[model samples]
Target: MLKYYNELLYFAQKLVGDKEKAKDIIQETYSKVLETQNKREIKNQRAYLYKVAKNVAVDEAIQNQKLQTAVYEESEHLTQKHEQPEEIAIKQNQEELFMQIVNKLPKRAREAFILYTIDEYSRKEIGKIMDITSNAVEKLIKRATLKIEEELAKKGF
Candidate 1:
């Protein structure tokens, strides 16, 4: 189990894209595996550990998505008294345009850009999460930025 710790952590990180969350998932996986082991005889511990980690990560992702949706819906009902209607509409339009531009990016480039800009992850951290070199992460981010800039320029903003 100790020998597989590093391997499982890397696997979980790739699945979830967050180091601390991956560690928590791995811990939960070990706990669940141990509880199951006590109940029955197990032949393949390594495979079992990976399967458990995958399942836990998937479950967490689903839960997070649901929570985010609920929060977004709730926030929609809470109006900001300070912002005028024009200001609110402009902000929403800007956000929508930015999202449209980001969606046009290639998958890897978009992920790198979002991790760096939106999620506030450093290039080194993004590289580790994406399993790429820091240089590769930089290139991806640059490509994404260039595409976004071009799109925004065309829109006269």
Candidate 2:
């Protein structure tokens, strides 16, 4: 267990992108693995540790997203107002155009961009989910952003 601490910490940091949060995740992973071990016989401790760390990181991300959404909803509610008909129409058209532009992106780039921006996933997480390297994920996202910007510019947006 002590021998795997540094490796697990590095893995967790890559997943969560924060040293302190990664440490917390490692602590949770160790706790869960220990609790589970006591309840039953264990096999493949290394894989189990990684699986637990990934689960903890994902759980933390979901909890954080929920908290952020709650705060955003509250603030939006406070600032809510009825939009004029023209304003509503303009917003709808802009959204439609944005979707069209996004759809024009190459498949991998589009997927990476949506995962990073719309789904709020970190590059490392996206890479894991997409079965790509983090550098590849970064490149795909940048490519998508540049294409979207060029399209918008052409459209006079």
Candidate 3:
């Protein structure tokens, strides 16, 4: 098992994009293999491990999509319905300020940051959605954060 660790990690990361999630999938794959209790009966342990890792990654991704959908639905019902005019004006001003900051980001970084902060997506999920690697997603987010902070400072916020 240890011999195949590096390959398994590479394969899982290719499929899932997130290093942490890939590691979790690898761990779960091992747990599933252990659960069988008939290791001697298997002929191709390497192939079996890969198969388990694929299935686990797919299952986790589907579960994550469902959870994101549920959270989005719940948030829809939680928005404040009644606001004083003064409060509404203030909120609008804040939104405008935020948008100004966000607009200053590079296109990729803007999308990543919005998906991560406003849409509540994981870095891995954001990578999948953006068709980029998780490491790329992380970089975009970091860049976006720095840009936003700089903009806020310039605006005396």
How accurate locally is residue 73 in candidate 3, as Cα lDDT from 0 to 100?
A: 63
- Residues 1-157 of candidate 3 have per-residue lDDT tens digits of 5676787888788767789999999999988977764645543456667778878987897788855654566476554643422235445656788898898788999999999999999999999999999999999999999988888787667
Could you give the C-alpha RMSD of every candidate to the true structure, in order shown?
19.2, 20.0, 21.8
All candidates in order of TM-score, best leading: 2, 1, 3
User: Which portions of model 3 miss their true places by more than 4 Å?
Assistant: 1-87
TM-score of 3: 0.43
lDDT of residue 139 for candidate 3:
97
Please give, for residues 17-46, the per-residue lDDT of candidate 2 as tens digits: 789999999999999999999998654466
Candidate 2 C-alpha error for residue 45, in Å? 63
Candidate 1, residues 118-140: lDDT per residue as tens digits? Answer: 99999999999999999999999
Compare the candidates by lDDT and give the number of the best one: 1
Candidate-wise lDDT, in order = 0.83, 0.82, 0.79
TM-score of each: 0.48, 0.48, 0.43
Off by over 4 Å in 1: 1-82
- Sort the predicted structures by lDDT, highest score first: 1, 2, 3
